[model samples]
Target: MAADRRVAEGLEHLKEAEKCMKTSFFKWKADYDGAASAYTKAGTCFKSAKSYDQARQAFLKAAECNVQNNVMFHAGKAYEQAGMMCKELNDLNRAAQLIEKAGHLYREHGVPDTAASTFDRVAKLLEPTNPQKAVDYYLIGSDITECEDRPRQAADFQKKAAKLLVRMGNYDRAVEVLKVEKKFQIEGENAPEVSRVTVELVLCHLARGDFVAADKAYKDAYGIPGFTESDHCRELAELLDAYDENDQDRLSSVAARPMFKFMDNDYAKLARGLQAPGGGEGGKKKKAALLDEGIEEGMEKGQLENQEVGGEDEDEFEGGLC
Candidate 1:
């Protein structure tokens, strides 16, 4: 009676709006159940009167009255609220179960993918005690949708799974997971899926430490702007022809090959610490660092005056290892 009296007093001004909504709701009754809405309005009025528990109970009754009417959306929302209430009461397991009910209803309504992903959120609450179960949910999250509907969906979930697999040392499976992300299984031959798959395939190849395979993959990935700039591709390029900083003689001698420019390899700074001193690897590094700075400084002397040979072809360093 107290809750009802508060609701009545709070809604004294909006009785007409409430009736209009009730009628509108009835007119759309077949598509959406409008009968249980009385409790919803009463709950709103109770909430406005600061009677929170009473407001919550009214919403619960509204949900109960509608669940028999097949209004899955309202039932789902009820589960969500029940879970919220359970959380405030510090009943975590019951709270998790309530959220899970909403997740299940979401699946029942032609949105299995969204449901599976939603379940992942709840699964996280249980992951510390149940990681393998989390992995199971993660895999299911990947499988609930067609690769064609939201094509990147598979890749996104699979990539997450692959990280877990990496922790498990399932490298082969991880690569395979990456491969699945490369495809549009339902797409036609001329579709963009082919190009997208090619980029994904490149990432898989790079993971295996095969430079030749990576080179081919890089070619494909480079065609896609995001892939080309990715850390994975850049790291693979570094490993394919990693320079030996300890071998300065080889680095500076006539047979020494030119290396990637500093801008191209961000690690050029760290690699400096490993080089031969003075001339061999070490001297070449100092020389390189000095030249880098010299080139940057504003010089009073002209290029011709500064050149021992020319700015580009100065005598290479020879003896600074010790």
Candidate 2:
């Protein structure tokens, strides 16, 4: 009964807020600020009454009213509240959308730190269900941090995005994000982090069955100062060697290392699935077949060469010049 009373009170406040938006001869300008305040009250009451849907609608109305009043910070906050209500209602998709809008509003209001944080929050929330969208938001957060000259923070966001992409089996995009993350680490003068990211880049290539790119990534890491001296470089070297030698046993050992195990969940999953190029019994059979083909071709060439020499000798003998 108390909750029902609160709901009725919320509806009355909502009506009052709506009435404030209507133009009248006595009011030359709409009372947007007053409407926003009333709508915010309505939202709070509805939320307190556990009416999430009505609370969400009220908060969204507050956000629009704040926007019309040119109060962007308040508008962003209102949108954030609406997003929380959506989360309470288990409407994650709408929650993500509203929170993203709040982030954009915060950015436009010249509060980039808040915007970046908002973006990051929404991205993490969406990670389990919509990884692609999570990657997009993470990248947006990375860009915002980068623009703020926060290289370390930017690299963190990029790393998160890269891992998600790797999980989705989007190795190409993962490599791209890892490259950007490496650049950020470089700009931050973090040699160890750069090396670590480079290792991830190489693993991404390898996971995609692109040994050439993986080798190139390893070689490219040498250009980064101190990368050659880092443990990551050595790990990469062993991993590459195992793949090149098609040594499945060695590959498994390398992939099971503590470093691989300590990586993010997605990267760890990738590492666990790493296989030597031309791995397994099937790969061994293929290698044996190729070797046999090469040997047979070489023998045929040798035989032809001998036949030519014999013919030359016969010609010389026929001419009495042997």
Query: Against the hidden reference, what TM-scores do the models get?
Result: 0.43, 0.82
Q: Cα deviation of 97 in candidate 2 (Å)?
A: 1.9
Q: lDDT for each of the candidates?
A: 0.53, 0.91
> In candidate 1, where is summed lDDT lowest over 10 consecutive residues?
254-263
Residues 19-72 of candidate 1 have per-residue lDDT tens digits of 434435346542224434665666567766666565556556556656867887
lDDT of 2 by residue, 65-112 (tens): 999999999999999999999999989999999999999999987999
- Taking the candidates one at a time, how many backbone clashes does each contain? 12, 0
Error of 2 at 121 (Å): 1.5
RMSD of every candidate to native, in Å, equals: 14.4, 9.3
